[model samples]
Target: MFGIHDLALFVVSGLLLNLMPGPDSLLIMTRSATQGWRAGSAATLGIASGTFVHILGAALGLSAVLAASATAFTVVKLVGAAYILYMAIGLLRSKAQDGVQAPLALAPLPYRKIYAQGFLTNVLNPKVALFFLAFVPQFIDANAPHKALAFIILGCIFNINGTLWCHALALFTGAASRRVKLHPAASLWLKRTTGGLFIWLGVKLALAKQN
Candidate 1:
């Protein structure tokens, strides 16, 4: 009725796509582990907001510019890579307690900051903008007069499902961290592990070429 097609398939595909490990997944899981589920939720909301921007941008045709321009893509990619590496460095050097001489560690990161980080991390990645341009339109009806609305509806559905999955991941990771924290220096190791992953993702993003 809304010029949406094969919505069941889209829903399944979106869930599967959300399952793929990336910065988004890593942030929420690590935040939940170190902070709490609330922090993860903030990150989820921020990421969702960023996805909305991509959806709107795609519907408004701004994403086409990214698709057509290599320089634009490269600029966004490098900025995103640098941000990821920045976060990686923080995680790498952070400690589990708030000490006078220690790095920002497992102590609670402000929800606003986490939210902003989530937004930046998701929005700065040019690949995500490209994905919206490439993926969301397939479900939009070609003959529909309100293609943008249809695109938005589908994007919201996709984001909603993604949020649910992220919340689950946060809860599970938080719970697991409690158990893991029983071991010696588990928190530090987890932070370092997450930092290593961010570094790998950062380098990968830096090396990404426009296709």
Candidate 2:
């Protein structure tokens, strides 16, 4: 119904796509490992909200503009890259504390800040908008009267499934992290390692081609 075809196939494919390792998953994992489940949940909610933006953009045909215009895509990509780089720098600069009331390797961000970070990280990436444009349309019947509605439906399905996976990821990562104690230096290194990865991701996004 609702101008959708191959509903089962869509669900399976969407789940598989959600399982792929990407920046979203990385952010959730990082929060879960370092901060705990609540932090991860905050990140997950932020990401889910951002994905809704993509869904709305796709349904509104805004994503098509990005596909059709090289300039628009480039501008967005550069902005996204810069933001990612800024986050990486923050992580890389985090200092470990010793002999304090509650000494920790990397200071955790407040839930609000973490939530905003997750939202910005997801919203700034034009790739996700493009992804929705490419992926969601396939399940929509071309002859459908309400193609946009169908697209939104598919996007929601994908987002819901992805959110479920993210929560599980956060839960497990947090639980496992609690079981392992890290040296101050090691935790600092962990933060930097993640930071380094974000840099690579930012660079790759900056260099992404419109084609």
Candidate 3:
């Protein structure tokens, strides 16, 4: 069990980390801007689901393998980067549609695919796995019975906090859907911009060194 002081510190640190802009936030915003509220929310859920995997990996000490091995890190990083780059290319290649339809209705919304993208984006990123390995153990009681369980509990708390923050972000970014719908050109530009961001993120990930 965590002491009040440790719990408070964990909450504060988690909030700070969640608020700091990162690849996950970028992804959520991209989906919100390009797709709509539903898609954004789906992405959030997908991200949350992925976080659970990292949490479990951390609890089981599996993430340490990724953290310690340069080859493992590089392989995961490149795969994640490749996936995101593929998404970017698909977005760039998409034909512009002319319509005043609701932004969510711009195309057939594939909720499952969006969710899969979110899940894969997080799970494939060795950085995220490494982060959980590093971040969650600090507050764990060294002498606690069931250290793994303690880690899992703390990770669950972090995931819950992060999920809520992401949901709020999705709603805020999704608000732009109305404007996107009002201008067809806006949709094209938004997709292009999102695609560009993904490309940059992909390159950055690919070139990242294990820390």
Best by lDDT: 2
For candidate 2, the TM-score is 0.64
Better structure of 2 and 3 per lDDT: 2
Report the lDDT tens digits of candidate 1 across residue range 66-145.
54554654465466567667867986896755211211236677999999989998989997887676556555444455
* Residue-by-residue lDDT tens digits, candidate 2, 1-211: 9867768866865775576456887788778778998888899999999999999987877344543554654465466567667867976886764201211234699999989989999999998987676556555544455666777889999999999999997887788774433345755665667667667766765675543
When 1 and 3 are scored with TM-score, the better candidate is 1
Writing each residue's lDDT as its tens digit, candidate 3 over 38-144 gives 78889889988999998897777734444355455445446656776786796566556731334333343598988888898888898787766555544543334
Local distance difference test values of all predictions, in order? 0.70, 0.72, 0.67
Clashing pairs in 3: none
Question: Which 10-residue window in model 2 sums to the lowest lDDT?
Answer: 97-106
Off by over 4 Å in 2: 62-106, 178-211
Among the numbered candidates, top TM-score falls to 2
Mark the regions of model 1 whose C-alpha exceeds 4 Å error after superposition. Answer: 62-107, 178-211
Candidate 3 overall lDDT versus native: 0.67
Sort by lDDT, best first: what order? 2, 1, 3
Whole-model alpha-carbon lDDT for candidate 1: 0.70
